[model samples]
Target chain A: DAGVTQSPTHLIKTRGQHVTLRCSPISGHKSVSWYQQVLGQGPQFIFQYYEKEERGRGNFPDRFSARQFPNYSSELNVNALLLGDSALYLCASSLRLGGSSYNEQFFGPGTRLTVL
Target chain B: LAKTTQPISMDSYEGQEVNITCSHNNIATNDYITWYQQFPSQGPRFIIQGYKTKVTNEVASLFIPADRKSSTLSLPRVSLSDTAVYYCLVGEPLPNSGGYQKVTFGTGTKLQVIP
Candidate 1:
């Protein structure tokens, strides 16, 4: 089976612009999470959706939002992109989420978003 | 979530057993330990996880002592291909700390295996 898949392998946006990144979870998976990875830092959590409901949110700004579809696919939107937003946007999927050992997330190759 | 501290980098030769330890001095009672491995331009892959004692998988072994103050990830007979970044993560955020749970990752330890 294919792992989590993301779209637009690379994206370029200018400051003050908006960008939307997409993700498709693996079959039978019900959870999708979004993360932002800086060049030299670890991925920071942005949002998590389970069964098309917002399950968790990170310490990101209000400009960052996400939603899940009935098909379990997800989209992460960043409004008024700032220069500090340039990083690899990663999407992960799992069977479910509630912490513990059951939350092993399978990640995607990531969508490299570059804000100029 | 508990904070983790690991060596910035480590170097080992082929066919050698490598053990990387992580320190989480402020761990909580319900927190579990997890490990992840990642290569350049790729997403992180789960290595092993353990609550206490020793847990071994086909890839590596995770050893958590009784106190749970720290943990060690041991890779047996590691080769050059095993070179990558290893991340030690504690459990999700506490209940009172908001419901924004996530797989928190720190600046992982970079392992360079020499052939």
Candidate 2:
């Protein structure tokens, strides 16, 4: 099966603008998650959605939001983008196993966002 | 959520076995240990995960002690392609949902495989 896929391979926006990143999970997958990885640092969790409901959120600010579609696809939106928002936005999909603490996620190449 | 600490970097020679250790001293009973590997400009890929004892896959092995305070990721026979950042993540279950939460991916261990 194909791996997790993300869109807008690269994007450039000015400060205070808004950006939306899209992702398509693998077939039969019901869970999707987002992460932000700044240069020279590990990826930070943003949000996760399963069964079309918001499941978990990280330490991100209110400006960030996400939603999962009926088909299991997901979109991540960041409002009032700051220069600090510049990073690689990654999308990962996984088959959730009940009663387990962790899900093995397959990630996409990521959408590189640059704010000037 | 439990925080994890790993080495900033490591150097390994090709064809040699490499082991990366992660410390989660504040781990809880519900926390499960996981590992991921990532290369430049790419998203992280799951390597292995385990709650306790030993878990091995075709790609690597995860060894967690009885205390569950720490875990080690063992990669058999180093190769040039194995050079990447290895992350040790402790997954915490959300209170409302059964899904796990990703709090932070600590400064991972950068492994540089040498020829």
Candidate 3:
């Protein structure tokens, strides 16, 4: 089975613009989470959705938002983007919302966003 | 969430064992220790996870002491392809009432495997 998949492998936008990144979780997965990774840093949690509802959010500002669909696909939106927003946005999928069995997350290739 | 501290980088020759240690002095009782490996320009991949003692999988081994304040990830006979940034994360397995599993990752240790 295919692992998590992300769309628009690369994106470039100007400051103050808006951008949307997409992710399709693995088949049979029920949870999707978003993360941001800046250069030379580890991935930081952004938002997590399970069962089409927002489950968790990170320390990001109000400009960042995300939603999950019934099919377990997710979309991450960033408005009024800034140069600091330039980074790789990763999507991960898990079996459920914090399932007790390990809850291992499988990540996708990620969408590299460059804010000019 | 607990804060983790790890080395910035490490270097080792091929076919050698590489050990990365992470310190989480404030780790909670319900928090589990997990490790992830990320290559440049790619997303992180889960390596191993354990609550206490030692847990070994086909790819790596995670050792957590009785105090649970620190953990070590051991990779046996690592190859050049194993070179990557290893992140140590501490978090609870269960989600909060809002249904979000809060996880925190550290700066991670970048491993350089020389052939």
Model 3: TM-score, first chain: 0.97
**What TM-score, to 2 decimal places, does chain A of model 2 have?**
0.96
Off by over 4 Å in 2: B94-100
> Which residue pairs collide, candidate 2?
none
Best by lDDT: 3
Q: Write down the TM-score of every candidate.
A: 0.94, 0.94, 0.96
DockQ winner between 2 and 3, please give it. 3
Tell me how far the alpha carbon of residue B38 in candidate 3 is from the true structure, in angstroms, after superposition.
0.1
lDDT of each: 0.89, 0.90, 0.91
iRMS (Å) per candidate: 3.0, 2.5, 2.0
DockQ of each: 0.56, 0.61, 0.67
Candidate 1 residue lDDT tens string, A1-116: 89999998999999999999999999999999999999878888899898999988889999999999999999999999999999999999988766434367889999998999
lDDT comparing candidate 2 with the true structure: 0.90
TM-score, predicted candidate 1 vs. hidden true structure: 0.94
In Å, what is the interface RMSD of model 1?
3.0
Rank the candidate models, highest DockQ first.
3, 2, 1
Cα deviation of B59 in candidate 3 (Å)? Answer: 1.3
Error of 1 at A17 (Å): 1.2
- Fnat score for model 2: 0.69
